[model samples]
Target: MAGDASNRDLPPVDVAVIGSGIAGLFLALRCFRAGLSVAIITKKSLSTSSTNWAQGGIAGVLDVDNQAALEAHVQDTIASGGGLCDEQVVRSVVYEAASRIKDLVDQGVQFDLSAEGIYDLTREGGHSEHRILHSRDRTGAEIERALTEGAADEYESGLRIFEDWMVLDLVRRDLQRPEKGVAGLWCLAPDGKVYTLASRCVVLASGGAGMLHLATTNPPVSTGDGVAMAHRVGADISDMEFIQFHPTALAIDSQHPFLITEAMRGHGAILLTRSEYKEWKHTDGFPSDFSYMNRYSTKGSLDTRDVVARATDTELKKSGDSHVLLVTEHLDVQEIREEFPTIANKLAEYGIDLG
Candidate 1:
């Protein structure tokens, strides 16, 4: 249900937040807690953002025994960024990761724990330590669920959510004056009416522009609407060409490609050449069959995403194969099933089982 704002003529609020993703929802929550009225506008349902579809865990330096982990995390991030990274920004965000994680936990976001009750940290590409905080394989969904539910108590009273409301542009008091700041938004409501919602501050949290590609793992709503509107309002955009592509998106003969998370490799799943996979298809599956990753890099299957993705592309093109196989038959079946119930169920539909 959307476009159902009963009080169209309501007074201006303290903040108008566009998009209902993790960024927008968390912003709204903080503003409301500070005694500010918030209006959250989303183009579609509140739960359809890219954050809800993310499979990987949030990376942070969390282990106490790993005292050198913080600097290591920073260095790894910088290396992954390939000299384009802002060192100060990287240091700030990495150092503050623990507190932000604590904030999420305080808001009832439960991450996966080992049998000993410690965090079940897993290593993905470009990391030296296992510092990822995740809830099984569906970390993003878990985060979205937690934030959405946590904000429910303050919804009607403190935060006003406008779903199916397409934000067309940011409203400025003086369009000609460049120094004048954003005042609010001009949104096209679901009721086929363009309404002007006023606020002291307007926040654009609309997600990335992955939909610009014909084939992408990004949600359909990721049409780069936020960037577009920001450009129109003369916002200074940076690093517009540095979009990262996931290396192992599922390439089945489907219109929408599903992401084959890099975490699968973190859990000992192997990427195999089609010929190697066919050779093992008739025999009992073994780990040796999926050992092709070592041929590409010294880190083997644990290489950084860009490396792994480029290797996969190279192998596919070299062999003229449409798709490659991710082999997990050697991993413990029960562990894989329980740790990745969502992914297991999804593969089950395609007659593939990690178990």
Candidate 2:
């Protein structure tokens, strides 16, 4: 219920999983269901991972209803991933996206549905269609909560969960095991005690490596620990460059960075400039002159994240402005409030009223 000390003398389990993020939780559930004893070790509280802070919905083909849309989405992802993306891996993950969502739904993960009872999908900047399945704006939170609950049920049986257990290094016996075979690990407990956990199989689900940058939406614990550890053990790393940056972050002076959900833009918001504001104020009396996004892509505000962010940065530089504005005049004020209550509240805290 609280914490567990590692007893090196105790018998090793079938599998030892590091990190309790989405990847870890799902791995534990699958292993448990397969009758494999699992021990999950996390460096902090269970809910403190990057999965909890994820606001954008997962990309999947839930509503495509045809192969063309699915192929297009896959192609778009491949293009965005650059030439480095493995076509086989892309096809594998894309093909499984729908089944994965279905599995989540079967596991009691509640995805948002429209009034017509179809899975409510949203369009993100890089995406071609409205294929992202979500549960309101807190989609990741919802999924994590469900997975955690499911994991708890497994724990009720015999699954082991260790919180505040930071892994210092992995223990691999054979350095020449074809694919970097793992044997065990050396971890540091919250009390500064060292642990040697031996296992038949070891999994490193320790999330992304976003902390290397000055400004990252990733949590404090995401320091590329897993990647670093794996690399230390001679494991090959891939895609070290594909870091996605959201176009809108709350541009406030704070010790910690806060991300403004891109879903707000998907809901019909427009990025405006100060000069464009002045021009619109004198002419149309509404900010419509800041249409630089239209020059890049037909998706405009709904362009993929990389496109929109680049466009926004260009506009800010060209206009000699520190901050660009996102206007949601097309969206009903009350609807925006209801859909993005957290964002509206945060903006209000900064003396900017959404209404």
Candidate 3:
């Protein structure tokens, strides 16, 4: 990073990437390896993005030889999209999953493996088969670590990383047609002075505007700065209406929303009502309970995230409760503790048992 605006001599670059999340860092790495002069501008340190807080895994069917699995993955995605998905795009991503997973692995992201020396895949909310590659529950953290280290190693090789800088707006070469016309960015340094850094191309990976919501699992940095800059420069922004909410979040003591991974439900955790929870919570071990999710969807808690979140919200509204109950007491406590040690320990801080 350069000095404050007064002392800085900003240089031109082939590409400028905003944000330090997985998308920005990965793209920056690829461009740097291609011998392009790359500069990454982030408002915070690389370790402070929403990606670091992501506990779920990346979905990829690595076994490319399995035609059935590949086709199933595509169908599952399209189905999850509820007839709104572009079939071509869904199939393209599904078919390319193996290659992308290989790319992540090449970047040194090590997923969990079983004793049989195979990748330990887990199934989440919507998927029919187990395809999620994770490092325990903190898959995103591991991926971010790999890319951050990769970027850090090449920082002195003309890979400029300007941290603690907020981009005010994107500069455009042409106002009439803004497609690929982004010239550079006007950014604010920590000292509150604005500076312009020119670039032939700029990539805005500044993540979503989830912080706009009254309650969200997004980190403080997710204020949609990149999107706002693009929109201000006459870029077309789509899917602003689709903000996904997690089905289970801990709102203890009115603190910021903390996500409880939905993988627990896929592992056979149940969502119970308050009364039902009071009745069966002390059982120590029970195979089944009344299917509360069945009232909303036939797939029950294993339904898609949007479906489950909506169901949970509706239940909260109807019951006039602050939250719906998600219990793992019936599941294997040892397996739960091992699989989700981070979540387990965090909950234990509040004197809550994950099991």
Residue 105 C-alpha lDDT in model 3: 95
What is the clash tally of candidate 1?
A: 0
TM-score of each: 0.93, 0.91, 0.95
| Candidate with more favorable, higher lDDT: 2 or 3 | 3
lDDT of each: 0.83, 0.79, 0.85
- Per-candidate clashes come to 0, 3, 0
| Model 3 CA deviation exceeding 4 Å by range | 1-9, 175-180, 279-288
Clashes of 3: 0
The C-alpha RMSD of each candidate to the native structure, in angstroms, is: 2.4, 2.3, 2.0
Model 2 TM? 0.91
Model 2 C-alpha lDDT per residue in residues 1-355, reported as the tens digit of each score: 4345547433577898998888998888899899998888889987778898887678888644778877987898887765667899888888889888887888788887888998878877667778888777778888889888888887788888888888788887887672757888888877677878888888999998778888777889888899998988888888787777778887766535677778777777777776665555566554434566778777777776888888888888887888777777646999778767767877888888774
Report clash pairs, candidate 2: 125-303, 125-304, 126-304
Task: Judging by TM-score, tell me the better candidate of 2 and 3.
Answer: 3
Quote the positional error of residue 338 for candidate 3 in Å.
0.7
Q: What is the lDDT of residue 4 in candidate 3?
A: 29
TM-score winner: 3
User: How accurate locally is residue 25 in candidate 3, as Cα lDDT from 0 to 100?
Assistant: 94
Worst window of 10 by summed lDDT in candidate 1: 1-10
